[model samples]
Target: MTDTLNAKNHSIEKYLRQDRMPHIWCSGCGIGPAVSCFLRAIDRAEIDPNKIALVSGIGCTGRVAGYVKLDSFHTTHGRAIPFATGLKLAKPELKAVVFSGDGDLVAIGGNHLIHAARRNIDMTVICVNNFNYGMTGGQVGPTSPLEARTTTTPYGNFEPPFNLPYLASASGASYVARWTVLHLRELERAITEAMIKPGFSFIDVIAPCPPIYGRMNKMPLPMDSMHYYQEKTIIRHGADPKEADITLNGPILAGTFVDIERPTFQDQLNHISSKVNAQV
Candidate 1:
């Protein structure tokens, strides 16, 4: 236990800006674990820290860019993808990683998400889904499960949530996966795989919003949310994305749903350019 703690502390000091020592995430919030898993994944993947560029939009998870010790951008609300897209295209050698909350990425930035996947850009997106707009208030969001309660959905959420993995796969993502904060090993593995994958890779990390979303939904303690995730999760690697919809109290379908090789947008562009030059 002591050695593990020491290792994590070392990783935090190495990967994050020490001046930002205390993060602003709430108690029992799962973003911390997600970040830890991410840090470990970067090392395990053998990626050079100097070659990574993390981009995030405005939200709770968006603060990651400001904290990580890497070339990062904290862009305008819902613009993380567009910003990352520009950065990736400009510096194709750098590993572009987009880290943000579901609200920032899928709600207002949904268009960018689909189009980026359609282009099969060489980028990795790590979306922390807490099922509500966590930063402002506990409001229902694009990924709030059906019947999930929140400040806005007092009675219960009527709208169905997007099956994130399914959406990414359908939008042409070259790699897709989902995992809760409770599954640290799996989460880290998925992030590592996504980081090394060549095309548009995405991972939906289901984290707890204990103070707001969880308390409102009856998971009062952070542990309560963690336990819920552990008990409800169903791992089915390579499962069909269409059958992975998440409901308020139903099983949480989690795993890698898609991973297929395809020429990236940059690769295609370079190919065409070479042909044009040859003909000219």
Candidate 2:
């Protein structure tokens, strides 16, 4: 067991802050695997780690920035996108990535998220949607399914959850996709693709929050949620984002919903700047 543990540690040490071992995520939490897949995507993308910047907001997923060895920023709650946007605008050479949870990205910082997409900012946003607010006592969040029970909604969540892919596509994301943590290979591939893609790229990753969200929903074990994902998820590449809404115990539509080219915010800014300089 010691040898196995040492070998595992040795393999992933390069990507992590070794001093921060034994993360705070609960047992059966899916954030760890999502982070692992992200690191693998970084490796697969083959971009210089020095040229990458990771920004995250407050949440279980936000803790990702603290563990990664790269240039990472733990910003204010729900402000990861704006922070990443600033980083990208200041140094357009850097590949900025916003890693945060659904509650942080879609609830508190939702306005920034929509505008960032509307402007077609050059960044990769990886939103880990675990249904409820895992970090803040499992309150009902923007992505919590209708009728799902949360700490704040003991009776049941009645508000319609946002179809994240649809929102991204409608807001003008150039590349949008959705996948569960169970689909590691596909999720890694999607992340790799998003990292290399220009303009606003959004990937909604459905991860399990076994401790809080899961227990409240009768899925106490992580494997149960993973199994649920395996059984309920439908791979529908290029499907209309509007049809991707997730309902309580409903079939999950997962795939790349949009991939197209458009003038990025930086590109347009540079063009306008050049024109202004020429006129002057």
Candidate 3:
């Protein structure tokens, strides 16, 4: 490979689709920062952008597929995982990274998410958790905290939100981490780790949707939501996963919660194949 081919470019603009410059996401939306972090992570990993496959679903964050200049797929809503799963299984050489919103993944695609984790599929899932469904007029979602207000939850939400990292860890994901936009460096590092890890890796990014979810609440600007994350996020390193909880109104438990080595889905499949072939 030529030196230019592997050169580390800090500016993600070079890798972005210029025609999609003016993204559909609202101003002050956390999606932009999340995309930047993801790009930075790819750069940090020293992986060829050509070798990466970005898969996304229908949501504000899903616009990432249209923005990045890699092998990208803009699939149906809540089905990015199944698409990514097939891509990874077919071309196991490709690095599959899925980017989706909380509503697209944990809600409508909840079964896929858990099953993917349980299978320990070799891929990385980056979920931009803005709490409410930002693309759909700020409706209540599975990631919306208890008592949070949304378009559908005018009287405050009565349901509980899923602690995504915990759910992933419990579902057999080999690696799980949660980071907010405030921790940009940490978020990048977590993403890079997830990408290189040889098993099912899930990163739930606590993003802020200023125009929709934020506006409905007191945070009217994207920076306001970012500052809120700065103030409400308690940085606890090496924290116990069992003690972590997603906070809707208070300080949130944020950190790289889980990292364990398990037999990857591919590895287990190969083992089974060898055993079956021996019997034949």
lDDT of 3 at 140: 95
Model 3: per-residue lDDT, tens digit, 1-280? 5553322544787778777767887877777888999998888999989899999998888889999899999999899999999999999999999999999999999999999999999999999999988877999999888878889998888997787878899999988888888888999999999999999999888888887877777788778877878888887766776666775668878888788999988999999999999999
State the C-alpha lDDT per candidate: 0.93, 0.93, 0.87
Report the lDDT tens digits of candidate 1 across residue range 80-157. 999999999888999999999999999999999999999999999999999999999999999999888999999999
lDDT of 3: 0.87
- Cα error of candidate 3 at position 155, Å: 1.2
Candidate 2: regions farther than 4 A off: 1-4, 7-11
TM-score of candidate 2 to 2 decimals = 0.97
Candidates 1 and 3: which is better by TM-score?
A: 1
| Candidate 1, superposed: residue stretches over 4 Å from native | 1-9
Score residue 109 of candidate 2 by CA lDDT.
95
TM-score of each: 0.96, 0.97, 0.94
What is the C-alpha local distance difference test score of candidate 1?
0.93
Top candidate by TM-score: 2
Q: Candidate 2's residue-wise lDDT over 71-93, tens digit each?
A: 99999998999999999988999
